[model samples]
Target: METAVKTTWKIDTAHSEIAFKVKHMMISTVTGYFEDYNAEVNTTKEDFSDAEFSFTAQTASINTKNADRDAHLKSDDFFNTKTYPEMKFTSTSFDGTTLVGDLTIRDVTKKISLEVDFNGVVVDPYGQTKAGFEISGELNRKDFNLTWSAVTEAGKIVVSDKVKLQLNLQFIKS
Candidate 1:
């Protein structure tokens, strides 16, 4: 039997981003990001099959441009950062494409899958090996207990249950 030794990679935060978009009032989209996050990637070969991925984002680092709105998201009605200070994901499988993992938010954990596109690997001028990926998925906020919502007099929903997540990640071999 052939055995493959996995290589570990560290996330290059300066070159990576974790962002999301949610519909507001069933109209425009509100974009946001987690200012602080980290991830680990382990792979047997460049193809990235039999890979392991894990990530965590500081709940308090959530930013939505509007300070008030950001604060509200961190409150008890939403993430309740004080109680659940971090969101996390651990991959169960990756076939060089789809990624299946367990996502935890506000102490609630659920199995979720994200579509992934590998952008190839490169060697930087500094001789650092790096890899890139664009990943996206949609999840219901309510599933993670982010049940806060409001309704206008016109009967419009203030916040939609579904949230769209986008991640542009770059990792450096460690």
Candidate 2:
């Protein structure tokens, strides 16, 4: 009988971040993050092609350095954290550096693909094995039911409908 080996990884939050950017005022881009999230990866060796991954983010933890703006985002006009407090992702397939998964947000589930670059693995000075990844993907907010906008007096939508996501994750083998 052949025994299968799997490696598990726990996200290092202090060294990981999830962020997004969107066009604002049709002139500049606004960026922000959830500030709190958790992720895990299970794989054979270091090949993501054989990996299973999942991540969860607290919707109410969004932070843009502005309390008022953050509060507004958590209101019913946006994430409506009281109703849907968590956003989640689970991978369904991995092809080389690309990951296909289902992302759930605001009670809507959408299939999304991410282009990932495995930054290879390293052995830290503390004698721990770790891996680093820089992954990015974009999804239309409308598809996830995040549609909320206002037309400005200048005729521009107060908010853009498209949101771009970027994730930087560092994981320690467990």
Best by lDDT: 1
Q: What is each predicted model's overall lDDT from 0 to 1?
A: 0.95, 0.90
Query: What would the per-residue lDDT of candidate 1 be over residues 5-45, giving only the tens digit for each residue?
Result: 88999999999999999999998999999999999999998
Query: Which pairs of residues have clashing backbones in candidate 2?
Result: none
lDDT of 1 at 171: 96
Name the top TM-score candidate: 1
lDDT against true structure, model 1: 0.95
Q: After superposition, how far is residue 144 of candidate 1 from its true place, in Å?
A: 0.5
TM-score versus the correct structure, for each prediction: 0.98, 0.96
Lowest-scoring 10 consecutive residues by lDDT in candidate 2?
A: 44-53
Q: After superposition, how far is residue 11 of candidate 1 from its true place, in Å?
A: 0.5
